[model samples]
Target: MKEKMLSFHDVKHIYHTVRGEVTATENLTFTVEKGEFVALIGPSGCGKSTLLSLAAGLLTPSEGEVSRRGSIGYMLQRDELFPWRTIEKNIRLPLEVQHRLDSESLERARTLAEKYGLGEFLQSYPSQLSGGMRQRAALIRTLAFDPDVLLLDEPFSALDYQTRLLVTQDVAKIIRSEGKTALLVTHDISEAISLASRVVVLTKRPARVAAEHELCFDGENDPLRRRENKQFSEWFELLWKELNA
Candidate 1:
């Protein structure tokens, strides 16, 4: 059996504001298996971001459980790279935060940056790189700590349509190559269909799983190529109906 990297079981989360208590998720349940990429899709204000926080342990569940078996890395909607920091410094930030900054670790980070075509740009600042490259650097920073699972919260949502496609391809390829389990929360159905081997759909606020699907593309793992598959539209339509219904 595949090892489970993360699981959310009957989780309920509430935000207590001065106005009142607001429940974001109720009885949310899902699991991300080792080396698997799972995309989460739902309507607007459906607490998808809340779910990522729950997975990352940034929020406590009001009810039930949130379980994780390994370290987690998070990449938010924006690249969140400090503009003043050079690409190399941005990548090494996590290592410093985790206190894993050492010659060996720094060397590994450098190797990763170079291996992924960011070597030449290491000395460049975030402002010096294109949007796609900034996102790439953000991901590498997240991976610098060697987290076992990745929680990507619409990491490509901020990019233009064309850049989104290319960045998704780059990110997915790197995640697969590194064998990291990933849970991506995206509003873009097409993006989800292209990147996920499995997808979990959530209902509107007070989020909960409404449907789940396993995607098959004859072992095609490339997100860009997957979009070209005939089945891509089929999955997209199914998900659209599910979300609308």
Candidate 2:
């Protein structure tokens, strides 16, 4: 059996406002194993982001628990790169925050940037780089802290369709190369199919696991290439049914 890296047991969440109470999630339970690539897909307002917020400890569950084994890195819909900071500087921000900013760690971040094709632009400001490059820098920043699990909340949603495809491929290759576990929440079914080892479907509002699909592709694991695989259409059809069911 796979050793679980994180577990959500009977998790439930509710929001209380002057307007009324909103039940965002109920009986939400799942397990993420070490090095697993899982994607969460659901209709809009299905509590996907709420689930990530809980995992990041940004929000407390109204019931049950969200438990994790190690550090977690969260990348939101926007790259959220600091405009004034250079690519390298932004990448080193996490290390600085943790007070672990030493020569070795900085060098590690530079090595990752270089290994992932961002070396030459290390000193470049965020405005100097293209959208895709900025997103790459953001990912390198997230990984610099060496988090055990990565929570990606539609990291490519802000980009143009073309840029989204390339960045998605770039990010997936980087994560797989680094052997890190990832949990991605996306509304794009095709995006989920291309990136996930296991795709989890959630129901509308008060989100709950509706179904889980494990995908297999014969080609290289590149996100774009995976979309061209024969299994791609099959998986897409299956998920389409599940989502609209």
Please report the candidate that would top lDDT against the real structure. 1
What ranges in model 1 sit over 4 Å off?
none
Q: What is candidate 2's lDDT per residue for 1-245, written digit by digit as tens?
A: 98787778899899899999999999888888998899999988898999999988899999998899899999989999999898889999999999998889988998999998899998899999999999999999999989999999999999999999999999999999999999999999999999998898998878888998777685367888888888889989988898888
**For residue 36, what is the lDDT in candidate 1?**
89
Candidate 1 per-residue lDDT, tens place, 65-176, comes to 9999989999999999998889999999999988988899999999999999999999999998999999999999998888999999999999999999999999999999
Compute each candidate's TM-score over C-alphas: 0.98, 0.97
RMSD of 1: 0.8
Shift of residue 83 alpha carbon in model 2, Å = 0.5
- Give every collision pair in model 2: none
- lDDT of all predictions: 0.93, 0.91
Error of 2 at 63 (Å): 0.7
Deviation of model 1 at 42, angstroms? 0.4
Q: Give the clashing residue pairs of candidate 1, or none.
A: none
